[model samples]
Target: MALLALVLLAQVPPAQADPPISQPAGPHAVGLRVIQPAAPREAGLPAQVLIWYPADTSVSDAPPLRYGDLMATRLSALRTDLSATQLREGRAQQQASLMRRLGVSGQAVLDAPLQARSQAVPAPGRFPLVVYAAGVGGPADENADLFEYLASHGYVVVSSVGMGADGREVEETLAHVEPQVATLQALIRQAPQWTAADPQRVAVMGWSWGGMSNLFAAARDPQIGAIISLDGTREPALTRQIDVQRLTAPWLYVSRSPDTIAQIQRSGIDTTFSLLNAAQYAEVTQLIVYPMQHADFVSRRMREASDAGYGEYSRAEVRQAFGMVALYVRHFLDAHLRQQASSLEFLARKPVANGAVPHSLRIDIRPPAKP
Candidate 1:
């Protein structure tokens, strides 16, 4: 399966330190903390939290978050199994293939400098807060373009990087997701930036393992008004298969229709059937498909990202796939935060030919827009 290849290929990104690329609108100061509950729980481990809010571009005193044993040392161990050159080559090859498929050379966005990553224009006001959690072993920068776009546009979105993958082993990646969610909720309680946050305007998003992380977080976090999952599978986080229906918030599931055809064909109908049998429904649940590969979601880092049997994209699909996800996310967040009546209109948008697909969406009710 491409997912298997993609999972294995995930190990090859170079371990080299990201170059010092600073965002210019501000120096981008940083703060770091660990959220380990005072009490014990199963497989208890400390989760790290990093805050990178708006900073003065002229400032140079910000300290980088330390992955500690996760990134620096553990990745060193993985090198024993996978050579650095091989990983770099794999990443470079994967990236090159994706770009060729996406069209255009160097013009593609990757490894952007801080000045370039920064926004010179100030936000209209303190934007809504978006809390993000990457799936097991997912990188914070994987969905970077989207996160940066939202932040630049005025929303404060926070993401937690999982501990597994890379050359290092983390809290066993998937195993750590639940705690990540717990810690995220805790952080919201512990921090002042959070109380100042808009309660009605918050959203959560994740991809792959991050998607599961996103769902688990939302299931536990009532403050999250909405959620988005990018090509994430549901099997990983379920304690019992019947637990899928626990979700109550608006949800948007974005999957690559053809890329996951085999995966869905193999298990789609069965899962959807069970999803319904389990009584899982949403006030707003919609799935959007793009004519691109699963890996296309990470357009910014296609080299370091790949999957087996994953074909490359043409420039058009790349523009459509990545750009589409961005647009979908922005629209979803705005609909929830600003409560635009038209935005919630999607909850009501569905094909007339509902019989054409095995699964159909049901939006219970759309809330009236804010005054």
Candidate 2:
């Protein structure tokens, strides 16, 4: 609910252009392409995905991806009449064009070109795969910065263009989680057509409701190499659906607040029926970012809030929160997806005071309790 509010409240009358934000500090340049994959099931959902990967060619000639379209599609999915409105009225395309004209398309990178299908790096030289699910009513590209960042760093990042929620109710949200995850898995299977992607070394991440879906997906398929949750929590109904006892993949949960953890515990989702529930789940590392909101995980929110002068933080402060989270994400993926053990040190270290921005990062690695 708070996650939804973050998206809703952050939207204000267009003001000055978004502040200049730092790009991901990866060595290789980023490339992006779009795909429309048919759902594996009769979910009536055609997954519109954005693929970001390492690029060998110059991407400066291309135009930035549309921000309004991604934001509009995401917002539409949250309402009950999405099909009748955006789908029937043809608003998605129109909205994207409008945003582009507004000069607030929210492009992740300036002029990152689409990589050619034929020139893709060959097999035996594939990159680790990552499928990221957006929060409820949030577009896959909501965290475009992170996706581009990971791709530039040599990981194939696949994110959906629009993950329809259809309704705002909690139960409606829960029912859609598994289907979205399944859709993501179906898209990953199309890796051979897009780039040199290694599906075997896959990682799945989500925010809020998507995080709940991430847990369900990992539970269903233990082969997932790792899981990342950006302030995601499991409801009582979700725990009833999947047995978390079967989850074994490594997990990284970064929370904006403790109330979420408290909610999970109160809902009886933290280790009552299953021996390996949240409290007993091994291989899970939890990180808390203080003075941050649920929306901070979303990069676009910071820029929008800063431009509108809506939130408490300044442009610099907002960029700082966004940067810290991005750094941790890069480190976590580097450690798990790339198998770089040393990267974990950045996550484990305590934050040092730098005056301008407060570094209130808390890390806790939880191993399975003694049986």
lDDT of 1 at 201: 68
Compute each candidate's TM-score over C-alphas: 0.58, 0.71
Worst 10 residues of 1 by lDDT: 15-24
lDDT of 1 by residue, 163-279 (tens): 543224445345555565664565554433432345556777777656656676666667778778776655632523323446666777666653356766776434434222232
C-alpha RMSD for every candidate: 11.0, 8.4
lDDT per residue, candidate 2, 189-264, as tens digits? 6665677788778888888777767777777775678888888855555656765566777788888745567786
Model 2 collision count? 0
Residue 115 displacement (Å), model 1: 6.7
- Top-scoring candidate (lDDT): 2
Estimate the TM-score for candidate 2: 0.71
Candidate 2 backbone collisions, by pair: none
